[model samples]
Target chain A: MNSLKQMLPEVAPPSREALLEGRGRLVAEARDEAASAGRSRLLKRRINPWTALTAGLVAGTLGVGAALAVQIGGDHRPPERVRLVSAAEVLSRASAVAGADGAARHGRYFHYRWQEISLPDEKSRHVLGSGESWVPAGGNGRGLQRMQPCTEGNAPDCDVVLNYKDGATDREGFTGPRSPKYLRDLATDPDALLARIRRTAKGDGTADDRAWREITDLITESVGTEPKLRAALFAAAAKIPGVVADMNTKDAIGRPGIAISRPGRSPQQIIFDRGYRLIGDRTLAVGKGGPEPGTVLSAYVLVNEDVVDRLPAPRPGLVR
Target chain B: MTLPPALEVRDDANELDMISHVNEQVATDDEIVTWSLRDPEVFATLYDRHAPAIHRYIARRLGPDLADDLMAETFLLAFRQRARYDTARTDARPWLYGIATNLIGRHRRAEGRFWRAIARSGTDAATESLAERAADRVSAQMSLPALTAALARLSKSQRDVLLLTAEAGLSPVEIADALGVPKGTVHSRLGRARRKMREALGGIDPLDPREDAIDE
Candidate 1:
C-alpha cells in the first residue's frame, strides 16, 4: 500500500513567504469587495422594498448546483473497468488489435465524417456536430452540400459552413505534406516506411517526432487506406520512442480505449479501442488564464469510415 | 514513527531536503485555528506545520505547476475560514486536505490527461527504483506506468477517497468530514477503489497480508 502511495509525484509546497503574500492578496481583495459593497448599500436601500424578492432571485440564481443535484440517484451500471496491466503490455495488445483491424480501404473519393467537440469558453463545451468531407481519392473534389439548420443565434446564412455547391471544375490535388501519390507508393515495411516518412518530414521537432505526427495524421484519414499499410503504420509507430500506451482513457462518447500521445502542455492523442481499432482523437489543453486544466480543446470520435462508389445522402440524425 | 513513502522522489530520498524545518511543534492545528480567530497571525504556525505535506499531496494529485498556487490558496482559505474550524477535531490536516482536494478537482481533466500521457509515453519512471528485484518493485511508484493510469481510470469520487486516505493520511472519519460524505460512503468508495486497483495490479493488493508476507 505504501508502495502504491509512493508512486504519486510530490509537488514542493509554496515558499513560506508566498503563502504570506497570498494571505495579503486575499485580505486586500476582501477589503476591496467590502468597499465596493458599501457604495452598493445605497442602491440596495432604494430597492429595499423588493429586498425579499431580490434575495430569492440571488439564491435561485446561485443554486445551480443544488438544482442539478439528483437526489436518490444510484449507480445502475458501473463502468467497465480495465484490469491493471503494464503500459507496455497494454500497448503490445493494442498494437496487435491495430494490426488485426487494419485492412486496405480503397475508394474513388475519400469521404470522412466525424463529430467534433470544442470548448468555446471555460463555462461549457459545444459540440460543433457532425462534419463530413469528401476528397478526391486523387485529392480533388467539389462540395455540393445540402443546407442545414443554423444554430438559434446564428445568422440565416450560418449554414454557410455546410451549404455549398461548386462546379466539378473547382478542384484541388492533394498537396498535403505527403503527396497523395507519394503516400500510395510508399513502402509497407515498417522500417522502410518510417525511413521514407522521416526523409520527407520537415519540421521544428526531431525527425522521429515529425514522422510520428505524420503517421498519426495519415491514419486519421481513411481515404485510400489499406489494412497492410495501417498495420505497418502501427509497427512503425511502436518504433518511435515518444509514442506510449495508456488504457485509462475514453473516447468522446465515454467508451474506454487505449491512447498514444505526445508529452507537453498541449498534446495531440489518438485513441484505440480494446480491440485496437482506431476510435477517436483528442487534444488536451490546460485552460489558459484560469483554473481550467485538462480542457478538451477539441475532439473527434469516428462514427464509421468506408469507401463508397458515391457519397451517400445525409443520413437521418447524422447532422444532429 | 513510520511515515508513508509518498510520491517518493527518486533522487530526493530525504524529505527534509525539500522543505526547511522550523523544528518546533506546539499547538495542534485545531488549537491554532481557534487562536487564529482572535489573532490571524498565529495561523502561520499551522501553515508552517502542515503546508509541506499538504503541498506534496496536492502536487501528487495535480502536479507541481499548480501545486504552489493551490497550496498557497489552501492556506489562505484556511486562514479565512478559521472561524469555522471544528475544534472537536484536533487535527486540521483533514480540513486543509479538504480545501486542497477541492482545488485539485478543478484540474480533474488534467489528471486524466497526465495519466494517459504517462501511459502512452511509457516512461513514468521512478528515476532509479529502490526494489531489490525488478518484479518486486512497487507499481505505485512512478516507475510503474499503468498504476497511475489505473488511478486515473477510477471514478472521480473513488479516486478522491483513495487519495485522501492514502496520500493525506486522513482517517476515514476525517475524509467523511473533508468530503462532506458519510463515513459509510467513504468506506464504500475506498473499498471499490482498492478493489479496482487490486485488479489493475493483477489481483495483487499492495496492502494485502500476502504482500506483507512477500516482503518478509
Candidate 2:
C-alpha cells in the first residue's frame, strides 16, 4: 500500500478553466450593469467619520503637512536647526525593541517596514499581519522606496498599500524627506503649496472654501489650544487644499509620543519621539469598525544614538 | 512494453522542479491577472497549466461532467475580475479556485446527487481509472458512498480549505486571502476538515497519499 502511494503522483482535481471561461464572458457582458450598480452605490456613499479619523491617523505617519507648532520654551523663532529624520531610522529602532523583527527597504516616498506587532485590540489580538511596504521620505515627491515583512501566511493585521510610486501624489499617507525649504518659511508664504493642493482637489469658489473649512476643522479638532499656531498651520494646510493631515498621540512601548497618519484612501499611522524623530508607525488597521481609536498601530523608538530600525516588517503584496 | 517518448517527457515535466517553476511563475494572484491581461490568449496558459489536475479533483468529487462545468466557470469568473486585480500577488490559481468554490457551492445539490449515485454504483471514474492504470489497486477505489457522505457532512469552511489546498493547489496564505480570513483560521479549518474526512472515511488510509502533505 505504501509502495502504491509512492507510485501514484497524487493527482489534484480538474482545473476550473472551462467554468471560468463562461464566467468571464458573463462578466464582460455584465460589466456595464455591474459598473452602473457600483456607481450608484458610490454616489449614495455617506461620509464615514471613522474613515476620516483613520485617514488622519494614517496621514500622521506619512508626515503630511499638518504640523503642530507647540510653544517650546517660549521660543517664538522657528528653530533653525530642526533635525530631520528618515522613516527607515525610526522603523529599525522600533523593530528591535518590539522583538517582532523584520527587514525594511527604503524608497523615495517612505520607508517600508514589515514585521509583526502585538495588537491588544479585540479584532486582532496577537494575529499576525506582517508584510512589506513603500514608505515615503520627509521631502516632496520622494517615490515609494521600501518592502519588508514578506511572509508565507496571510497576516490580516497587515495593510496592503497600492499604487505607491515616485512623482505620484502621496495619496497613501507615506511621506518623503523634510522639505529643503524650511516649513516655517513656507508657513509665512504658503500660496504656492496651498494653491497647488487646492488645484489638485479641483477646488473652485465654494468647493475651495469647503475644502478650506475641512482643513480648519481638522486643525481645530487636532490642536485647538494655540490659536496663533492653529491659524498658521491651518493657513498652510488650506493653501494645499484636499491635503488632509492625520495625527494621533499614543504610548509607544510605554513612552508617550505622537504619530502622523499616512495619507491615502486607506491611511496608516507613524509613531515618533517627543523630539520629532520618526520612530515607527502603525502599519496595521485595528479595532472593530476599521482601525480602533487609541490602539498602538506602530512604533519606532531610538535604540542607539545613530542607528534606528523599524519595529515590524512592512505589509507585503501590492494591490494595483 | 514499449515506453512512449511523449510519456517520458510528460513524466519529466511533472517533476518537482517543473512544478515549482510553474508555481514560481504564477506565484501570486496578481501575477495571474497581469499575465492574463497582458495576453488574453495566455488565458488558456493557465488552463493548460492547471486544468488536468483540477479536472482530476472534480472527477474525484462529482465525476467528469460536473467537474467540466465547474472548471469552466472558475476561469471565466477569474478573467472578468482581472481588471480590478491586485498585482502585488503573483499567484492567480487560488483566486481562481475561490471563484470555482463559490460556483461549486451553488451546485451542491448536483454534486451530492453525483456522489450518491457513484457510491451506489460502487464505481467512481477517477478511482476506477486509477485502479485500471496501477499495478496495485488495493485501496485505490475509496468507498464512494462513504466519501460522498463524509464530504456532505463536512462544514463549508473546512471543505473549502481542504479542496482549495488539495485540489486548487493554493498555499495556506493564498487560501486565507481567497477566503478573506486570517491564516490561522485557514490552518485550523483545514485541520478540522482533514480530521473529519478521516473520521468519515473510517480512518481508512488515504487512497494515494501524496508525499507533499497539504500542511507541509
TM-score of each: 0.38, 0.34
TM-score of predicted chain B, candidate 1: 0.77
User: Per-residue lDDT tens digits of candidate 2, residues A127-236?
Assistant: 24333343333223223323233231333233433332332334443322222233333333345545543554333345555445333333322210112222343345
lDDT of 1 by residue, B132-169 (tens): 24235444332455776788789889989988877777
Candidate 1 lDDT tens digits, A1-320: 45455444433444434544554655454455446666686787788768646655765789843433322122233112211222334344444444444242333544555676775444456676664555443334433222223332442212211221221222232223344445546635778888888998766577876887787776665333444555666666667664544434666666656666654422467777644567777765534675344445677777555545675554554332
- What overall lDDT goes with each candidate model? 0.57, 0.43
Cα lDDT tens digits for candidate 2, B1-216: 111111001111110110101001112334334434433433443553455555665655566667776666666666667776666665666666667677777877776776566556644554535423332332443444555566667776777787677655678999988877999999999888777776765554333355223223
At residue B18, give the lDDT of candidate 2. Answer: 9
Residue A315 accuracy (lDDT) in model 2: 32
lDDT of 2 at B153: 76
Q: Score the docking of each candidate (DockQ).
A: 0.07, 0.05
lDDT of 2: 0.43
Highest DockQ: which candidate? Answer: 1
Give the interface RMSD of candidate 2.
22.8
Q: How much does each candidate deviate from the true structure in C-alpha RMSD? A: 21.5, 28.0
